[model samples]
Target chain A: MAPILEARHLSKRFRIPSVKRSTVREHVLGMLRPSSTEELVVLDDVSFSVERGETLGIMGRNGCGKSTLLKILSGIYMPDTGEVIARGPITPILELGVGWNPELDAIDNILLLGSVMGMSLKELRQATDEILAFAELERFANMKLQHYSSGMASRLAYAVAFRAVREILILDEIFAVGDAGFRERCESRFRELHSSGHTAIVVSHDPRTIKTFCDRALLVDRGHVVVQGDGLTVADAYTALLTHEPAAAAPTAALPEAVPAS
Target chain B: MADAPTRRHHWGGLVWTLVRTDFKARYHGTVGGFVWALLKPFTMFLVLLGVFSFIFASDPVYKRNLLLGLFLWDFFAEGTKVGIISMHQKGYLLTKTRFPSWIVVVTSASNAVITLAVFTVAIVGFLALTGRTPSPVELVLYLAYLVAALLIVAGISLAGSVLFLRYRDLNQVWDVVTQAGFFVAPIIYPLNILPERFHFYLYLWPPTAIIQFSRAVLVQHDIPTLRAHLMLLGMTAVVFTAGAAIYRRFAPRAVEYI
Candidate 1:
């Protein structure tokens, strides 16, 4: 199948300035002085694509640039050098509750968040009932988001994503939201999305969801994709790397593409 | 969705929508709620007028005219003060989605306009009550002042909003300027009363010219000569041009900082 999204040679580098202070006084006086600089290469020549109706997962440890890749793909942050082509209406659920207003009630936040997501007020009203019901937040719909537990906010956020007419769903480790009961609900909603042949890109550390929900996986070490092919092989490679032993040099030995040209 | 071709230059409507959301959120809680946008400024005008006229042995003509100038100046000062926080206030929206960055500045400036609309009623009503009826020409002059003032304030505020996102020192400086400007911008003093040497430079402040124009049309009942109107309008355009150039160039970087 033709790819719905493609990223090529994407690289993001960030400068973190530091002071080369000669004395403690200079370090303290840097507030009134200038400083030197350092740099971090967050994503180096990373590239991938997602086919229509396919679920792809990104698995990495913290600070492994998984979130940075997601941000670049979502168009939140432009890469230092690269380009992205998205085919359809892409919804990037990066940190589900980021759009919420603490002072506004759940209902008001629903409208506000939905509006930013490109839904009109009239259209949001139509979807409101389904969203609230799906979130199981009937009673707390009028409560301020700050008052709700983090889990409750997650449920509402999920409801918003599921109800939308999404062509590409970008998930940033959303499975860890809410309690066990809410997790079960999230699993069902996710399954419902996948079974309908929907397109999704999930960035997560959780092994189970990546294995169960995603048809393929990309394992990132530092800023490079060390392994990319099938889900099980990628998962095993990722786990092995974390175990401190050398990961399999060829995680996807079975896939013909994994073998070096002979 | 497939189409013949989608235009890339359709962010104006989206910017407008965000501006509307900002106006709603601004006056969300109050005694009269959003209506106070008009009432609060007018109340300040009346109280200032009362203090100057009733307590101080000030001339009635200058006092009333000065009140008119204060009304116009208040709009400019308060508009920019609130606008300086436009990007910072909407960090939640800015950090998440990547829409046109100018939406925050436009929204904040437009919200100030909503309050200015309220202050306007107080201005006209107070003028009518004071028995200073305006001729049609004078009425046109008042509107011209409002147009110029809004343009200048919107421009300055847009630039200021983006700047305030990075350096917060400007926030305190702005408050002090407005506090001092309320007295210095010919809001409470008469430019005609000052020497002719200061008169030309007094118009250097676009807002001062706007406030003086509003008073000339409303309280003085004089149809400012065409030259006066043209001068004010030209300066208004320049102020807006500078503001727009600064905002468009630098406002996009604000999202990165946020």
Candidate 2:
């Protein structure tokens, strides 16, 4: 099958300015001196692809470009030297409730958040009751979001997002939100999406989630993908790396096929 | 899907929705709600009335002119103040979504417009109570000046909002500038009190021209000279164009800083 999404030679660098050139005097003085900026390479020549109806798990240690890769794939950030060819509409739940207004009521936020995530107004209006019911927020629909707890807010966000899922979805640590019950609901939703043949790029640190849900996976470290293969190999490598165990300690020897290094 | 709704919608509906939410959210928890919007200008009017009413007790028209001037000045001052920080205030929207950034600034300024509209009703009611109804042409001229003032303020606000993102000191500088502007513009005092040489400077600042031209037509029942009208239009165009240019150049990259 043809790939649904492909990122080629993806790289991104964030610049850290050492000087404060806010004032006119400092601005001129800084121009006279050598430029003082340190570049942090967050993603370095990392490339990957996800086929149609595929679940690709992205695992990495903190600050290892997992979220940045997701952002680049979602077109929130322009890669310094790379291209992402995506075949279908992509919904990125990078940060749940990122665009929510705390002062607005739950129903109003539903409209705002749904439209912002690319759902049509008609669709949102039609799905309002279902979304509110899914979040268990029907009672608080008229109340402002500020009155809702963080977990409740995320639940509402997830509900809206779940209703708006299309052919391609990029979830960056979204499954970690809410309580155990909501997480279970989310897991079931993931299963539903899986059965429906939706292509997904899921970034999570949970080994079980990867092992159970992902068809294939990639483990990134320090802006580079170090392992790529079926879910078990990549999950085991990630677990072994986290536990300070060597590659041989991860049942790599017992497995006849070795995971490919990306 | 790769063909997601990246295409910008006809954003009029969205902008209006945002504006309504912004306006409503501000007063959601407050006891006064929208009355707070009117409270500031009315309180200022009372204080100014106490200070200047005695001095111009013999001339009721001077008192009316001063109040009108204060109302217009308040609109310009409050609009630009909110507008300059509008982009920063909506930083979440900017970094998270790909909507047009200028609408953020416009929405912020529109909050001031809502307050101005409320005060206008009071002013119109007051004029009717005092049996001094403005001619339809005068009202039209005054409305024109009011619009020019809003555009000029919005233009300056757009430029300031973008530049202020990179330069944190601008808020302090703007506070000083607007305070200085409050004194220079004919708000509490009439333009006739200033020396002839400064009249040119006043005309150059679009807000000042707007305040004076509006007062001339609405309060004094006098038509503005053709030169005065031309000056307001010219300054409005220049400031608006400059603001749009600044916004276009810096707004796209502004999300990175936020």
Candidate 3:
């Protein structure tokens, strides 16, 4: 089957200025000096494809460009090179409750953040009670978000994302934020979607999550895919990479292409 | 499914909900709530009205003109100023969601539209209190000019927001420009008080045409000349187009820079 999403040769580089110029005068003053900038290549020649109904787990260490790859796939940051072709609606849970107004009540946030997530107004209206009930914040539905605890905010955000789930979900370490109970519930929801054939690209540092939830997984180190195989194998590869052991160096050096999925 | 494109088309409801949230956010924690939106322009109206009225107590026409001009000026000034920084102010939304960037500009400006509506009612109330009936046709023309004024400001805001994303100094520069505009556009004084050579300059400024055209139709009860109407149309087109072009050019990479 043809893949539902394709990211071809994606690359991104961020230019960091060595000098800091906060004001117009400082900027002008620095113009007379030699200019220097360092380019941080976050992603380099990264290519991946996800078949319809497939959950592709993305595993990497910190600063390994996993999040950058997700951002590029979601169109938040246009890649420096290459392109992303998505066949269906792309829902990016890059950050939950991103546009939530702290000054507004929970109900208001449900409307604003829901619509911002591309759920139609009618859908949000219908899902309001469900979201409030799911988040277990129905009692505080009218209270401003500022008064809610951080955990409550994440719960509310997760509730909203749960309702706004689309054809293709791009999740970036979402499991890292919520509590244990919420994480369990999220895992179950992921299982439900997994069984129901929803395509997703999940970025996680947790090996168990990648191994259990994904059908196939890719291990990225230094912005390059080093291993691609069944979830267990890739998770083991990621674990080995984390232990400062070069367990997959021979395979990585031998084949630049992703290890074909079993 | 094929319904993906339709999902992107649903920004209208999103923009409206966002505008509503911002409208509430703007007034949150403040006493008198949205009344503040009217208070700034109305207070300016009162101060200028009191000082100018004492000087020209005999000429009620100038006071009324000033009252109306101040309303239009406040709409233009407040709308563009808020609109310019709106995109950056909502960085949370920009960085996190796949929302269209222009909606940020529109949502910011919509706040001013609400404030403008409040002042619009105030203007009508003043006309009634003074017992001077504006022509019905001219009242409609006044509404049209108000929309034109919004488009002109919205255009400037689009360009200004993008410019500000790159240059933080624009806020200071915008302050100076609006201050210069307040004095130059004949908000407190009548347009005729200025000499002919200055009239050419006024013609070049879009807000001047908006204010002068509004005064001619609403206050003076006379239709603007055809050339004057075309000039307003031309200026709105030029500013809006220029602003849209600038915004489009910068929008793709705006997230990185901002």
Candidate 3 ranges with C-alpha deviation above 4 Å: A21-26, A250-262, B1-8, B29-31, B56-59, B125-131
Best by TM-score: 3
TM-score for each model: 0.85, 0.84, 0.92
**Candidate 2, residues B1-258: lDDT per residue as tens digits?**
133334335455557567767777887745489788777777888898899778767765777777777778888888988888888787765655445678888878777888777777788788878887888998888789878988898898999998888876677778888898888787787677678998997766666788778778877889988886887788899999999999998875676666
The 0-to-1 C-alpha lDDT of every candidate, in the order given, reads: 0.72, 0.79, 0.80
lDDT top scorer? 3
State the lDDT at A79 in candidate 1: 74
lDDT of 3 at A237: 88
lDDT of 1 by residue, A56-166 (tens): 989877887898888778777777787777776666777667667787778777776666666667677788888998889989988878898877887888888777536
Which stretches in model 2 have alpha-carbon errors above 4 Å? Answer: A1-8, A19-35, A49-53, A83-89, A97-99, A120-122, A194-197, A228-230, A243-262, B1-13, B29-31, B54-60, B128-132, B225-227
- Candidate 3, chain B, TM-score (2 decimals): 0.92
TM-score rank order: 3, 1, 2
How well is each residue in B7-92 modelled by candidate 1, as lDDT tens digits?
23334444555665555456664536776766666677677776666644555576667556665676787778877777777777
lDDT of 3 by residue, A1-262 (tens): 6688988888777766678554455677788897666666667778889999999999988987888888778777788788888887777776665556778899988887778778889889999999988788999999998898877887888788777877788888757766677788878887787788788889888888887888899988777788889899998988888786778662332222332211
Q: Which CAPRI quality tier does the interface of model 2 achieve?
A: incorrect
* Per-residue error (Å), model 1, residue A199: 2.4
What is candidate 1's CA lDDT for residue A160?
A: 82
Task: Summarize candidate 3's per-residue lDDT along B65-154 as a digit string, tens digits.
Answer: 887788788889989999889888877667765668888887788878887887778777777688766778878988889889988988
Q: Positional deviation of B39 in candidate 3, in angstroms? A: 2.0
